[model samples]
Target: MSGPNGSETMPLFEAVHDQIASDEDVAALDDWLRDNPDGQRQYLEFVDMQHEIERQIAGVFSRGPDSRTENATSKAAADGFLFPIHSVRWKVFAIAASLLAAVGIGWWGNSRLDDKPIAAIDLDASPVSRVLGIVTASENGLAYSGRRKLESGSALRSGRVDLQSGSMKIRMESGVELFLAGPSQIEMNDPLQVQLVSGTVTAEVPDSVIGFAVKVPGLNVVDLGTSFGVSLPANGQAKVHVFDGVVDAEVERSQQRVRLKDRQTVLFDGTSVAESSYDQDLFVQPGMNRDAIPTTTGDVRFLHTPPTSVRVGQFEHDLVLCFKERTESTLLETDLPVSLDAPGHYRVKPRWQNFGAVPRGTLVDSYFIHLDAIGPEKRTREGSITFNRPILGVVFSSSLLKGQNEIFGDPRTAYVTDRTNPKSDPTLENETITLSADRRTIRFSWRIRSRSDQVRVFVAADR
Candidate 1:
C-alpha cells in the first residue's frame, strides 16, 4: 500500500496512517513527530514511537484468560508508559491490530525536512555532505577543520571540512556510510559537497541521496545515492560504481554528466567521462529503495549487449535467469536456462521488457546457467548476461516445478488442456503465482529450434 500520498514503501508514514485511521486520532501526534526532525531523525524517532504506541494500546485490554481477575493489574500497567495486557490470546490480536492500523501513516506535512516528496533532493544542504562533527561557521568562511575519526556511528555537521588524511568511518545519517581512505577534503554545504582534495573513498548508500559526493579537480561525481568506490586515476581521472542506486557524474573539464545505476559505473579520464564495470563482493548486502520496483507487465530487452561474455567451458549451455526489483512489482523471469547451442560463433540476442501491461520501471534480472553435459567437444557451456527495461507485461516464471513430484503434497496433477479450470487457460494472465491449497495459471515463452516465430506457452496448476 502507498504511504500518506502514494509512496509504496514509506513504512513510517504507512504505519502512522494505519494508526490514525483505526484510532480516529493521532493526526496531532503524527504531525508533531514529522515536523520535529529531519527525514533522518524522524525515521529514527518513528521506530521508537511505533513501539511505544503498541505498548499504550496493549494496556487498554485485560490479561488473557485472566480478564475477570486483572482489572486493577491492568490499570497499574496503563499508568506507566508500558501497557501490561497479560492475556496471551488478546495480546496477539492487539499486536496484530496495532501493526495493521499503522501500516502506511507517517506524519508528513512540511516539505523541507521530513516526508519531503519521494525522489527529491535536499538542495539546501550539500547535495551530498559528510562532516566529522562540529562545523564552525567562520567569519572568513565555513571551516570543517575538525580532525575527527568518523567511526561506524560517528557523525558531525559543519560548513566545510577537508579530510586531510586518515581512515575514518562516515555515515550518511540515513544508514548509508562513507569510508574515506586518506588525504581527501569533504566540503559540506547543506545538501551538496565536493571532494576538492584527493584520496580514495568507498561509500555504500542503498537508498538514494544518502552518501558522499565527489568534486574532482576537473570533474564532479554527483551521487545518485548508491554504493560504490571512487579512485583518482594517474592523470586527473576518477572511477565510480552504482552499486545500488544511481550516481550522477559530471565532467568539469568537459561539461558532461551521466547517471549510473546498480552494477554500473563511470570513469573520468582527465579529459572525458566513460562508463566502466567491476566485480562486486558477494558478502555485501545492498540497501533497497521501496519505490523503485516496477509493478507492470513489460519487457526487458538488451538495448546494448553485456560486456562480459559467458565462459563456454565452465557452465552448461543453459542460462538461468533471476531479477532484483520491489516485491510488489510482478516479476516473471524464467528459472530455466536459455539454450546456447553455439559458443564461439554464437551471439546472445535475448530481450527482456516491461510491456506497459501493468506497472512501470526497469526489471533487472540475472541470467545464470549450469551445464551438466560436458563431453570432449564440451557438452554444455554456461555463463551470464545482465539487462533491464522499464515497460510492462513481461514476467519470468521459475522452472523449479519441472520434474518435481508434487506441489502442496497432492499427487502430481497435470492441468487438463480444456479451459474448464482457469489454470488450464494459457491465455489468462495473473500477477500472482502460488502452488498451495489453490490453483493458478502460468505463462511461458518458448520457441522451437527452427520455428519462424516464438510461441507463448501456458500451464495451469491445480492445488
Candidate 2:
C-alpha cells in the first residue's frame, strides 16, 4: 500500500491510514485480507512502512532537521535533491500536506453527497464515569474490578464486579468496606449503593457514608449507618442480615417498608418479607468474627491468640487448644480425601480417608485442634469441642496434616512437618472419636506422648 499520490491503487490504504475508512471500505478490505494470505502479509508490511514514515514525519516537526535524527536514506535523498536538510524535510511535509488536502476534498465531496459528517477518530469523545475502589485484600479469588483483575490496589469502576471464586475485600471511596464471597455478582451503582445479583456480600458502613444500600431481589436494604449482609441464592429467596445499627428494607415493586435493627434478619421470597433472628455465622463471608467458640472441658484451653507453630513440644503445658483457622477459601489441593464433604455424623477412621470426594465448586475453612506435647509425663488427655457449624471432615494423620498446614493453616502461624519420620505412628488405642447427630460437634480423647497430637477439622464454609 502506498500514499494516494504515490500510486492510484492505494486509495483503500490511504483511507485507513487517515482514520477515514467507511463501513463498505472496511468490509471490502477485511474480505480481501481474509481471502488472500499473501495480500494479508503484504498489507501488514505496508502498515509497518506507513508507521515508520509517520514516525519520521513527526520527528521533522518536533525535532528540527539539524537534530540529525533522520536515517542515512533521508540524508542521501536530501543530498540527491541538492537542497539543505531543512528544505528537504519541508518538501516532504509539503507533499504530505497536499495529500491531506486531496483527502479533505474527497471527504467534503462525500459529505455533501451523503449529508453526514465523516465518522473519524477526530470527533470529540464522550465523557465516561470511571468509579474506582481499592481492594484491601484478596483470598484465592478471581474477579475483575472494571476491566482489570480485582486484586489489592485495583481501581474499581462503576460497573458490575464478577467474583468467580474465593473471597475479596474492597473499600469504597466513601469509607464503606465490602466483604465479597464468590461465586457472586455485585454491581457498584455508585460510591454508596451496590446491587447484589447472587451469592453473598457484607458491608460495613462508617458514619461518613450516608444512605449506603444493598439492592437485592424484591427489596432494597438501605443502611442507616449500619453493617449488614445480603445473600441471594441461585434458586432460592433473598436474605438480609443486620449485624449492628438499623436498616430499612423496602420492596421494589410496592415500596413496602420494614425496619430491622441489631440482631434482626429478614427473608424476602420475592413476594413478602419475614423477620427472623439474625444468625451472624450464617454466611461464611470474609472479615466475620468467629465468636462462636465451642464448649470445652478438662485439659482444653480455648486460645484467643494461637501459638506461633503447630510443631511438637512447642508448649510446656499438656493441653489441647482450639481456634478457628481462617475464613472460607477455595481448596486447590486436599491433604486427605474428605470422608464427609456433605453434612453427616461420622467418626474419622484410618482407612476412611481417600474414600470420599469433595464436591466441585465447594469452599472450606479449617479449625486447628492442637494437643500440646508436654515433657516426659506422656499423660492421657480428654477433651471435647462443640462447633456451631457443620463439619465436612477431619484429618488426624501426621502425614496428612503436613500436607494441609500451608493449605488451610493460619498463615500467620508456622507449622513443622518432618519428612525423616514419615512412618511415625498417628493413631493411639486410647483415642476415642464421636461426632454428634447433626455433625456440628466432635469429642476427642488422645493418649498424649512426647510429640503433639494434632487434628484439623475441614468444615463447610456456608450456613
Candidate 3:
C-alpha cells in the first residue's frame, strides 16, 4: 500500500514502472511529466535503473542454477552463512525483470522511431500553373463538351477551346482579356501566349501583358501593348488587324516580319503578304449589340427539290426564290420584310411583296452582302463577303437593278468609258470595289448618298 515516499498511496510513477498501469493511468502520468520537468527526468532515470536490474537478473539466470548455487555456497562459507539459491522470491523477481526489460526495450525503440525527421516537400516542382484564369462567360456550344464542363469562374488550364457555334470570353491572370468568336479554335499555350488555330479572336492586352503573342498557322503575332484582332479561316489566309498601339508579325517559314501600327491591317497567306487599311467595323466587338446579315452569292442554280433552309448568324432567312424551267424571267419576288435588329446594320427586303415557287432547271441570281453596325457618322461604309461557292460576277446599285437596268458582268476589267465622259457611267465613278486574291470575297467601299436611301448588291450565276 505504501510507495517510494513512504506515503499511504502508490504514485503513478510506481504504477507505470511496476507494469500495472492502464492507458488512462499512463495518461495521468504523462500530464504529471508535462507540469514537472524534474519529474520527467526522474522518470527516465527510474526506467534506466529498472533496465539495469533486469540485465543483472538475466545474467544470473543465464549462468544456470548449478553455477549460481556453487557461487552462492562459496559466498555463504566466506560469510559464515548459507544462501538459498532456489528461493521462490528470487525466481519471481527474475521473471518480472525479464518481462519488464523486453517492454522497456520495445518502448525505447518506438520512441527513437518517433524522433526521426520527415522528408520535406518541394512546391516548385508541382505540375499545375501558379496562377490560373477563369471563364467569365460562354455562349453557344463548346468544342470539347466531353472533356470538361465550362461554367462561370471555371479555372482555365493549358488546353484547346473549340468554339463550334458561339463566343466565349476569358480573363487571364495577367490582366489580359480575350473575346473568342465561334467557329473558332484556339489553344492556351500559357498565361502569356495563345495559338489561334482557326476562327477569330479579339485580344485586349493591357500593359502588363504587352508581349503576349498569338500563334497562327504560319505567323507569330506579338502584341506591343495594344488591343488587336486576329482571324484565320479554314481556307483563307490569316489576317491581323491592329486597333491600337503596334504589333509585330513574323512569318514562321520565311522569317519575313512586318510591323503594324495603330489602325493598320495585314494579311499573310503562308507565302505572300499584303497590307491594307484596317476596318474597325468589320468585326463585332465584345458587349456590342450587333448581328450579321446572311446572304448567298456565287453560282446559284435551282434545285429540283427545294433545299433545307439555312440559318446564318442569329436569324433565319428561309425564303427561297427559284425560277422554273423555260421561264422567260430570271427573277422572282417576295413580300417578306427582312428586318435587322441592330441600328446601323442593313437588311435587304424584296421590292415586290409576292413570292412564287419557281420551276426546276431555273437559274437564280443572288449576292452576299455584309453591312456594318456602325452609325451614320461614318460616311464611307465598307463590307466584306467570303463566298462558299465560286462567283461568276457581282453588281452594285443604289436602287434595285430591275428590268432595263445596266448590269456589269466584268466590272472594271476593261476601260469601256472615257475618263472625260462623266455622265456616261456615273455608277462606276462613285464606288470603289476591290476583290481579294482568292476571288472568293469582295470588299466594297461605298459613299452613302443618303441615310434613308438603300444600296442593293447583286450577283449573277449561270444555270
Best by lDDT: 2
In candidate 1, residue 431 scores what lDDT?
Answer: 19
lDDT of 2 at 357: 52
Task: List model 3 lDDT by residue over 218-333, tens digit each.
Answer: 78889877888998877768888988889999887788889998878998887756896565654556773111112222211112111121111111111111211121224434
Per-residue CA lDDT of candidate 1, range 1-463, in tens? 3233345335445555454333423453355456455543645665666554443322212113344536643664454313333334324433443444457433222211221111121111221232222211111121235654332212355433455443444433233345554555554332224353455656665332332465656766666556666766445567776656677777765677787777776777777777665635311232334232212111111111111211222221111211221123223343322221111222214332212222223232321111112233321212222222212122222222121112211121221122233232222112122111111211123221211111111111111
Better of 1 and 3 by lDDT: 3
In model 1, the runs with Cα more than 4 Å from the true position are: 1-155, 159-166, 173-176, 206-212, 277-463
Q: What is the lDDT of residue 348 in candidate 3?
A: 31
lDDT of 1: 0.35
Angstrom error at residue 292, model 1: 26
Clashing residue pairs in all predictions, respectively, total 70, 0, 2
Q: Model 3: which residue pairs collide?
A: 324-359, 335-353
Per the 3 Å backbone cut-off, how many clashing residue pairs does candidate 2 have? 0
Using TM-score as the measure, the top candidate is 2
